[model samples]
Target: MQRSSTEGPSQYPHCLSSGRTQEAHLIRKGEDMENENKKSIKERVALRNSLVKEALAEFLGTFLLILFGVGSVAQTVLSRGSMGDPLTIHIGFTLAVTMAVYVAGGVSGAHINPAVSLAMCVLGRLSLCKFPVYAVCQFLGAFIGAAAVYGLYYDAFLDYTGGVLTVTGPNATAHIFSSYPGKHLSILNGFIDQVIGTGALLLCILAILDNKNKGAPKGIEPLMIGLIIMVIGVSMGLNCGYPVNPARDLGPRLFTAIAGWGTEVFSAGSHWWWIPVAGPLVGGMVGAVIYVLFIELHHVDPQKTPEEENSMKDKYEMIAMS
Candidate 1:
């Protein structure tokens, strides 16, 4: 989400706003306050943002993200020594993430990845009720996106692999959907790689979004995030394909399992599926907490406004008079 500088104004209002009600609720001697203050179910629901709408935005955004990101891998792998190289894959994902942010940022903060959603929930920036909703929507979107790629590349896939779907070596395409550790890596190395990669991802995102830093260059935070991802891929991706997102890996991996890759999808690389899921969650929290400890928590609070001071005095005087 820009919280953008260049993008004029966001198309939708933020579900979370900073304003608070300032009215006084003076008690009467005989008022039945508890009953009177009780809200109807519909009223309470109306007071909050619609979970349906937020989830829908997340789905559409994540759909676009995986459609481009995973589809690029399919293109690269299926091309087989011709086009769609590693650099192209990086560019594809960078654009994919940027566009996804644009799609969902207005309504749902464009948290196309579950790690981002989990971080927001931990920071109390997003409602706990909506965290699971966002994560589920993202996973579903990724699944559908992978299914689309399979359908689009079916002929090319069979041609490239000679009708066999192998996880490694000649004619292998499993890496198009999920991640695997490098040949020299152990299970622990792969896990640490994921943790560090995802941790870096979150750190970049938090820094870009924090105004206390150099204040992002307007509407380009999304662009910045995408580039951050590309940088991570270029630098840290060799260890395990940098599947910093769980849905990005698991969704497509699950699809491959159903589409013919079978149990091999899960059995490969010491059951590596869980690392992208669990590692990002832990790494994202680590990044957020680091930002708080180093930057946010240390910043001094601004002094109260004169209007606030006057209001406080007036409220106290009114209490004494009563």
Candidate 2:
């Protein structure tokens, strides 16, 4: 049949519209199927135990911390300081801390250090019951991280030490895994150094997290904390190498003891094994208490003061008139 010009235009557009409508419907159907598949996978794999999930996060976070931090030290020591310097160790730890926090902060707050966990508990930021579990996971993670570094650098270790590991003297490699006091440092001085260093750490952390006191900008807390660690390591690392975290020190120490260095890692620094553990625990609490007394307690009420309230009211009235 011959069609009028108007009828042909109208029918052509209707066919085009029908085709477009079918295309849209097909697209929507495909999207719906994809979404359903994603939902099914999530339902099957999602963790049900909150505690276990958090523990795994803490474990992995601490593992990453020790892996890089100790790996840096190993490189420097094995290369006889030719590859990297003391500053390299500090920078490595800074990056390690920052990255670890980013990896686990959402789930476990990345308390890779037992001292930090205990401090959070004491400050009421973390539950007291969770502290033990978090601490244990952190320790285990550090232990595994140390093992990884040791295995990775096993050839370097043999080359550096000639297959003999000692805790002290020219070829001692124990300090690569754990902290040891300098020759000039006394046991008492080492303990004091750890306390001061860890106290400063906790003090700065509490200040950073206090919103009323103007906490760090969102998404930068991990970086800030990492920088704080760098500062502490540079400024206070002379004595006992600033092992402010019990898990950071002990886990690697235990690993070294088992791996090859024997028990001397614990006994070398005048039986200094306990100072890093006890000092940080005490110092963290002290720092948290100090922050609460000096700054946290002094925050003004969130409610607006009468003078500010009247100022706001006057501004509203001025806006209405304008």
Candidate 3:
């Protein structure tokens, strides 16, 4: 009879208490989920912004690259009253590419050229999603840069031995831009040159970018890349125009056609155009494969730790700055 006081209503109160506690726990979990969602959204937004910035950097970098590279050609051609010496063109392009790389290397990896981007993609160094974005930006930048060159050299265009602003004329074809090589060199020869030239160029690029390479100094990647370009230009400019990068040749080549060089741009009468596009791509793949097999696949020296690598990078950066 005395225990009856603890029964009935008290039991109901206990049940209500347990239900309230369960509801509170669920509300807390919901709040946590909301906070987590907010954090994810912020991260996504930040990543999106970063990608946009990188793309813009790429656009600007490529614009400058084409401007200087093709602009140099216009200057030499107009000033000297000739297409200028081939060696001069070679040297001019070499320096131009080097300078562009140095200026934009940090921002956009200094790809500046579509072929380089493509090669990076094939080598697994660059994401496939970024390939089209980089290529399109590079192509547009080339056209704009070419337009700037045309504006600067308007008077020179008039004096050009080739017809000015005409896309399809005999004089314009040879003087203003490249034409299919005469006498029809064997495809094998052209292919060989392109493979060798591009392979060498890609090899140099890999070497410079490899953190494990004792000789590769950080910040000096651009200089080394530039020097390699110069050497290639000097050594192979004549043989195949040494367009080891597809973007270097095609982007500017397309602009040249649009700026009045004409349809002949695609005319590799003997299928020569394929050489430039195919050679560099294949050679780059081969080079990347070789690098992975020979250098990256091998085990790293235990002594060469991340701290050592960082130190090396710092030293290189200091050297570059100096």
Candidate 4:
């Protein structure tokens, strides 16, 4: 979680090198083979603290988000206009965001949405090396969650469609997994809607996390974020079903294409599969740049980059150890 300044002139930190130093001292004295055993323990610990852990956390958090969100949609659609309504879905996604953040916030920043991950990377809040890892894990988690939802509602899915899965039939199932723009909206207009919706989502995210800008009272950000998702869902859903997150939409759409929904999942609404993926990434970056220009540009503070801090720590540690 933190880099210490006193690394003692070694590639590893003070704690890591202390054992090596002792081992080297003992080897000269021909004491024992105990130092060899110590080496493996250090390697194991280092591996545990690496990017793999963060990716797993991202995966689990995204899984929670997609599983429940898809489940809510299935419940609403399968009930044939009876069980759950639009509000039910809004609450489901709101809770999904809240619970997913709680699940991964401590470890991976809980960037279950790829849009959020991209925005953070753009803002220098996260390492670029970890971006692809987080994105892949998120997509995989979403895909698996959608698959699980399909399995959970297997009976209902078959009953509703008579075992024939079609995008625009009496038993349409694709919409439950991926979004489709309303009939009244043009493709270009739908794309614009996605841009605006995701842009707004990212803008609010930046505003809420800005400490200098009176960010959300700590511990309440996740809740407030959920409310934002709910509000966006209700307010901006008329045009394109409000897919503000790429992973939340594309991952499930891909799974549906592979699972049983056929290519119609992709071909639906004029090959509309790519909008959610491309729009959010572009919108997030725009939002980040806008926030920085409006707020960070005004504030004048000398701050060290994380890489700089880590490198400085290495030098200090080496000097101290020497």
The number of the candidate with the highest TM-score is 2
Clashes of each: 3, 0, 2, 5
Q: Please list the C-alpha lDDT of all candidates, in the order they appear.
A: 0.84, 0.90, 0.70, 0.86
User: Which digits, one per residue and each the tens of the lDDT, describe model 4 over residues 185-282?
Assistant: 78788778878888888888778878877789989888877888898999998887888889999899989988888998888888888888888888
TM-score of each: 0.77, 0.87, 0.70, 0.78
Instruction: Please write out the lDDT profile of model 2 over residues 1-322, one tens digit for every residue.
Output: 9867777656688788999999999999999999999999999999998888889999999999999999999999999999999999999999999999999999988888888888898888899999889999999999999999999999999999999999998998998988887889887888788878888998998888788888899899999999989999899987778889999999999999998899888888789888888888888888888889999999987998899999999999999999
Which regions of candidate 2 fall more than 4 Å away from where they truly are? 1-31, 302-311, 318-322
- Candidate 4: what lDDT? 0.86
TM-score of 3: 0.70
* Candidate 1 lDDT over residue span 33-136, tens digit each: 65555545446655355778789889999888888998888888888747789899999999999999988888889988898889888899999888889999
Model 4 scores worst on lDDT over the 10 consecutive residues at: 6-15
Q: Which residues of candidate 3, in runs, are more than 4 Å off?
A: 1-48, 81-84, 162-184, 302-322
| lDDT, candidate 3, at 297 | 78
After superposition, the stretches of candidate 1 with alpha carbons farther than 4 Å from their true spots are 1-49, 300-322
